[model samples]
Target: MQEISYPEKIDPRLHIYPSQEADRLKSRLLEHHETGILDAIGRELFTRMDTAGLVPIFVLRGGLALKDAYVEAAGFGPAGVIVPWRARHTEDPTVSYASLPVVPGARYALVDTLIASGRTIIACLQALRVRVPGARVDVVAPFLATAGRERVIADAADTHIHCVWHAEDVDGDGRMVGPGFDVGDLVLGWQGRHLVWSGERGERA
Candidate 1:
């Protein structure tokens, strides 16, 4: 079993929970086709996050793969106010689709499978600022790259970021290196193809 490691000193606002299951899942992500394991890991992560009083409100398109698990672990109903968001471009991400509800002063948790470049999450934060001003947002993910962590902290200093696993950095293609692949694409059935939305609303360019 490969041991999980972390930096000597991590950001105070960033929370990382090392899990043996997550370690196994990371390896499985490279070879497995089924998402049941991913769902299981997501459930555990969300369940742990529930203790922090985080409420599920917004989820990115790739995060839909773990929606069911989050809903179950967080004890939220299927009809909960979890809005789906899409961010385009890594250089300067822009929200393409997100029906954010106006909830000033409300604290929200934004969900995503992984944070590689941090551009997508940054864009989501920008959109939330416009649609739901004065809202406090905490980002949740199963895995996070070191570069992404630094970028998000620098860009959104007030945001609290949580992750179950950590990667040393991102690869040239902007995928987490420890895992060496895109978790979102693998679980969402878009492996080896460009990452795009593929849910009830269908794939968007």
Candidate 2:
């Protein structure tokens, strides 16, 4: 990777679970995906949506990851629409999400590969709310940090956060962990690349 450059100010909420634990968790995350653990998690998320009258909308993030494959095997359905969100820049880092049809008072599952700082997830959820008022949001990721979950909840009280691996599961030296070492890099390396399903199953891709 690109030498793992980091921003000047690190978020205070970041954590490093411990070296041994971090290594173990990292290995297990890969193992889970290969062993269909992530698939089960995705199915469970879908089940939750069915019960709550929500729909799944996978976020096509900018990173070069196999998120599309993971979501596809889990049965999310080719890449279609893009939900734009403002990334954290040194200057104004206001977050946003693309406008989409919102079922009145319904739930929407915002799926992504991982959540490091939760900045992007928070931005997307908040913007989504603005576009579709009164809709509940569920943030799903295969891996994420505890701080990310807390931040999402803090930013959107009605948002439900779920993940396979928490940041507390990994080891880091505070500022040097999580995004510092490129936590999602492994997904990028996973070989089963596939087109991310856009919109609903029958929707155009």
Candidate 3:
């Protein structure tokens, strides 16, 4: 990774959560994806979206936590629920039904707390393949783990992963351009930088 760097300012909303809150959230979302740092990263993401006519689409299971956070950040009236069910630890999505209720003809954004291994995204694609069909997919997350980022490309394949910022590393091995604040595996390395999902190739459906 590159040298460490911090932005002129870290978003204010992220600071709203007390250090204890981050610890508690970290424990809950440990196996649940990336809720710990999502709060920290969500501020940058919310700023990008502007919440102007924005509806949220959480990928169920994995995205449930993110959806909850997004709603808390943006509110329920501004954001609606649409969950896509897909297996996380298993390869079979049929076991859980891969679909979410999209209000149909409504503009929405997909939010996930983290993209750790991109398995969430792969499973998400399987579910969305039938439910959403031809809709545009916008992904949001806090930290895109070093190992997880590789799969993000394959998972995104042909869509955009619009997040606040993607960290180069969070393992504390000192590889990330910036170090994530100590919050277990969850941390905010940097803010206000984005990378295009070049994996979005052709005929994702």
Candidate 4:
């Protein structure tokens, strides 16, 4: 078996995404809902976020990342979750950016399937600040990369992160090392056409 590396002091905000514990959680979630286990996980995530006084906003990107966002929002009950703004950013240094319309002094919860280097989330938070000024933001994801987590922690002081698992490394394309696959790919594939991969179980793809 291959060894996986994690942070020395594991973050309390981080939860194990793929493991016996998660499987057990899934089993418990299934007692109330009939959707796939991932959706069950999304619903569970919403419950946690609600306890924290946060709302869910699905990222606009396609695939499981977006699906998980919708699923989380749906789990928020009748009124649904808030999606105050939608913005996208790139890594290109020469590119210009703009902020979207936001409610001043409002709090938002950003949801995505995975975090690679934290660039996109940072950009999104920055844009939100432009519109809402003192807006507070929380990021939620099923998985997060260590480098990405560090980058966000260093650059964005006010933003909170809630994720189920953390990995040592994730490439620019979002493929995590040791696991040797991307959660986005697996989740999106599962959501789209019923494709399945070994990485969902923490096995190399």
Candidate 5:
């Protein structure tokens, strides 16, 4: 539970809770297998959001676990679409799925577990923009890297970004600092690529 200082030019659209509070909640989430604590965190985030007529858009794999908690906490139904994305050293980041027709100028909450380099989220945003011009998007996650936050803010200045904790830049070893674990793998049980299961015979084309 540490205090995080922000620069004078920090974007007004970026919202985050205190690290101490986030740490407490995150620990409970891990201990309880991401059930109650996830809902609690979601409630905290959704209460601050203007959720009326909002559409929830979950990113696949990593975001799958968050869907139920987020929807229940927000008092909404299931997401209409899940965007499958991949961002790895072996391939350029991409959003592989096309969503159902989007409503122009509608509000969307793009849910993901973590934002490390922001490449995946950025790629998702690009696809969303193409489908729903002038749509208002809010990038929601539990943990986010400082660099990733900055990158999203720079790329989508009007988008609102919300997270429980802010992590330091990715380390040289490619570890995300604050969370201290691979959230995707932890939530999903096993992971290779988002599109491919660990024990699968081969990656999907």
Candidate 6:
């Protein structure tokens, strides 16, 4: 949000150990940076990236922002409906699909808020596999929790991550503290088929 000049390569965080002040700041970031830039990223994907032979995946609850961002910035293909296994024991939201099955010939861009141990993303990805075996896909999460990214990379060797930012703990204090790492500040545009880089000066230069 602070004039994103480069992509951040800071390590990601997996746990949610937010302090009150951090919470307040995160709230502000949500209002200003996270939400706004999401729209910008999705629009860029639509107009700049190839969208012909892929599916847009929106995981429930958290996927709302990604969905809105995409729709507002760049309406891609028709979204194939899917909901994640919500954290157990909460009153259920009205789910469109009582049950969903993976359908082949489709690619999924798994959408979510941030990565954490990839429990959520892995679950969603597995569910897609269950519904349609061998479904080709990528993930479009808003940000990459540094901790989760390693596991994601380990679990799905071929999985791709497109994110607005990549948060990390530079001090190695085991928490995302100090100046927040901004991956967008390091790279610009799609860096590879699996990941896109943005906010980096090298690209502009």
lDDT (Cα, 0-100) at 80 in candidate 1: 22
Single out the weakest 10-residue window by summed lDDT for candidate 3.
Answer: 196-205
lDDT tens digits, residues 67-105, model 1? 788878766532223333344333455565665444434
Candidate 4 per-residue lDDT, tens place, 1-205, comes to 0132223455554444344444465344335332355565555454445433444455533123445444455444211122222222232211133333344434566677666667666766676666566767777775577877887778877777776556546655544444333344444444333332222232122
By summed lDDT, which 10 consecutive residues of candidate 1 come out lowest? 77-86
Give the residue spans of candidate 1 off by over 4 A. Answer: 1-9, 51-53, 77-90, 101-105, 178-184, 190-205
**How far is 149's C-alpha from truth in model 3 (Å)?**
3.4
The whole-model C-alpha lDDT of candidate 6 against the native structure comes to 0.49
Candidate rank order under lDDT:
1, 5, 4, 6, 2, 3
TM-score of each: 0.77, 0.52, 0.51, 0.57, 0.76, 0.55
- Over 1-205, each residue of candidate 3 has an lDDT whose tens digit, in order, gives 2122122232222211123333443444444545445554455456545565566666544455455456666776544334333222243223143333456564456566655545555656555656667765555655445555556555555555554334445343322333333222232332334232213221211
Candidate 4, run of 10 with poorest lDDT = 86-95
Q: Cα lDDT of all candidates, in order? A: 0.66, 0.47, 0.46, 0.50, 0.66, 0.49
Instruction: Name the best candidate (by TM-score).
Output: 1
lDDT of 1 at 65: 68
Error of 6 at 56 (Å): 0.7
2 versus 3: better TM-score goes to:
2
lDDT of 6 by residue, 1-205 (tens): 2222135443232212223333444445545555455444544434434455556776654565556656655554567556543323232222224133344566667766555446666666666665666666577664455665676667765566765445542223332333343323312232233332223211212
Which model is ahead, 1 or 2, in terms of TM-score? 1
Off by over 4 Å in 6: 1-49, 86-104, 169-205
